[model samples]
Target: MATEVSSRLFYHFLGALKRTHSFSNFSFPLGLPQTSMSYSASKTWISPQTKELETWTKIRDSIMRISPRSPFIPKTFADWLEHRLAIKEDQLRKVVRKIARISGRDDRQETTIHPVLGVKEIEDRRALVLARETIWRQSLESFPGRRLAPWPSYEEYKHEGDDRSKSGYRRFLPLPRDPGNVTVNWKQRKPLPQYLFDEVGRRTTVDNEEDKEPGLDELLAMEFVGASLILLLDS
Candidate 1:
């Protein structure tokens, strides 16, 4: 099932790559008549062209990052799609910013009169979240007739089975009962040392006491050597 999903994702990614590659050959008609149009109209036209340039620059950067020869390629197809979705979301944000600037409106507004046209940061985030959810659902759909079960609460799990000692909480199964589950008793053989529970400061004090200190004889020998050096300097 995993292999089948992987193959499908691989082909889908290849198709996307082909489409992105084709975009490189396509050029936008930016050569408009400067004299025929008013200053405001020309400004409106130039803004889109500028946006396109920025889009292409971003695309080029993405291409460089996800190059075939690059070592840091996404491990899974979902990850690759997520990367593309992030790029699209960024483009959407730029569009939203441009629209806000043109309309003289604050970008903080969550929603507007027009649902499709009026996109704000919050809406973009919501859309991104929805897109991620959709991707995850689609991936899960590969396993036919198998839906993920919700996690059981502690109270529910504890009282699941009749037998308290042998079943229920003792024989707790976190996953679906497909593969066999093994139960192992992780009992300790020996008791822990009493010093293990000692306070950090106490432990440090003990360590300091255990460490060998400089002898009094060694200190006197160093003092004598210092005196001899002083006498030689005087001479």
Candidate 2:
């Protein structure tokens, strides 16, 4: 599920990246144009949960170091890339404060408050989640009978590396539903619009063989898009 979600997000990320001209601006692209971006245990043995959190951390920290305290809205892919990379440490601290306030729990305690689903940051977070789900749905429709995994909950990834420590660990509020009910009803799920399916299909080989990995371009697109999605939701 994690793999599927990330891959789908990457698929969208590539389109946005291209539209923003992110690839052309960089002197050297993050991943080779021909390299596979699909999730592969052989590429990196880390768990998807840990890898995603780590990727978010890396992109955020890297952006904070390079971006200004008050950055501008990106006008191009390069600009967007730069903007996405520019995160502030204080912004993260502020999220902690907001989560604490909403959950009525001390920051020091483990929280189950889903970071992106609550009312305070509802709009942006909700959009991010929906965007992911939308992409996943389209992928399912594009290649019928594919055995893609389910998307993990926003709450599940909230504490990816927290080990219940008081010093560095952070927790969030859980989703307001029975875990069993959270699963999607396959029969009732909606597919991506035909136009989008056609566009995305023409853009990349999203309908690859079940066992084959995505090509390099698809993988690279996901990396930037996936990281951007994380930051956007966090914001």
Candidate 3:
């Protein structure tokens, strides 16, 4: 994760390159200005770009004092940080909107409106809640018939004189004395699909760095897996 200090430092370096240029024997690949004087003799104050760079440098230094990570690499960290800021800003706006709604001070009428939008806030909220509840009930009711829990008393396979009276498989058996249903096994958890398991194992374990074991993408996907994304599957 990128810190605030490193991002500011990177931008400050950009501003600094823009300022304090020497006209004598000057060269710039990034299109920097070639100035007649490095520093103005008339004023003790620095140029606007230089001042901006200095201000950001001070702020960066202050943030670094609090942040723990060091040896910052600007390219990867700063670029990722800009993306993270956008995600965070969107989240913050949602929070502010929720707060505004709660306080009865929401500015719903004044803000920019989408041309084809159909639903209002309260309607959207109600619809979302209803949809979530419906999904929850559907999941609970839609138990996979073959997935019996692995209990101490229950047999994975049928035994001689084993009572089939209470067995779900026996009740749902299409034919009398169906040995195919009798031999079939049941599991508790919804096992990952063949492809998903293969992908997850390869991405998280086999393809990852051997010493480090797992990399960013695999770790992120594993950590952020919400229960809602999971579905019933065979082992």
Candidate 4:
């Protein structure tokens, strides 16, 4: 599932990069048949990156505002792509924070407390959960029905090279000695939407006796139906 999700995201990212590159090269033709001031007045230059960011923000907002009861769902390929992008953005934020902490560049500790779900919210979530389970079961029973291998237990995994004192296995590895010369400006990167993050957290925390909600990538792999439903319900 992880491999599948990664491959899908990789293609999406590649296509986005290509689009950005193509848009950057776009410009008005040098020779216009009509010498009208309207052309010059309408000439507005927006960086491809800026345009991309704006488009992303709009999509993210639209997805986040969707209600669970709405018939509109991420059933189409395009809708799923947008959903995947939103999940990817959230994952990127997590990765950035983790890297910053590992490099001793971030020290702030923040706690988030989500509000309790209302009666209507609970019913909506239950409906979504049922939908998710149906999809998941169908996927499992599809052609070439083969069970996946169980993940290795902590005791079975090797930890010989790990630094026991550190939180992570690779924490002992040194970072670049000259950190001031970094090329990428991390601060310039857009952050995950707060509402999206909150929604993801809320949905993932929903408990079920038969099957627990999976991680974001797993949800993406399962292609759960519903608009903004991707992040609206918890694993």
Worst 10 residues of 3 by lDDT: 171-180
lDDT of 2 by residue, 90-113 (tens): 345676788889899566978677
Query: Which of the two, 3 or 4, has more lDDT?
Result: 4
Q: What is the TM-score (0 to 1) of candidate 1?
A: 0.18
Give each model's whole-structure lDDT.
0.44, 0.42, 0.41, 0.44
Clashes of each: 0, 13, 0, 5
TM-score of 4: 0.18
Cα lDDT tens digits for candidate 3, 1-235: 3466746654454443433333323222433343444455642433444443444444455656766365542234354446434545565677679888889966576887774335533322212432221212213232333232233223433431244545533432211121233335443323323212224335434544656564545554555663345322211
Residue 148, candidate 3: Cα error in Å is: 40
Off by over 4 Å in 2: 1-4, 12-18, 29-235
Q: For model 2, what is the error of residue 48's alpha carbon versus the real structure, in angstroms, after optimal superposition?
A: 20
The better-scoring model by TM-score among 1 and 3 is 1
RMSD of 3: 23.0
Show model 4 residue runs off by greater than 4 Å. 1-72, 105-235
Q: Tell me the lDDT of candidate 1.
A: 0.44
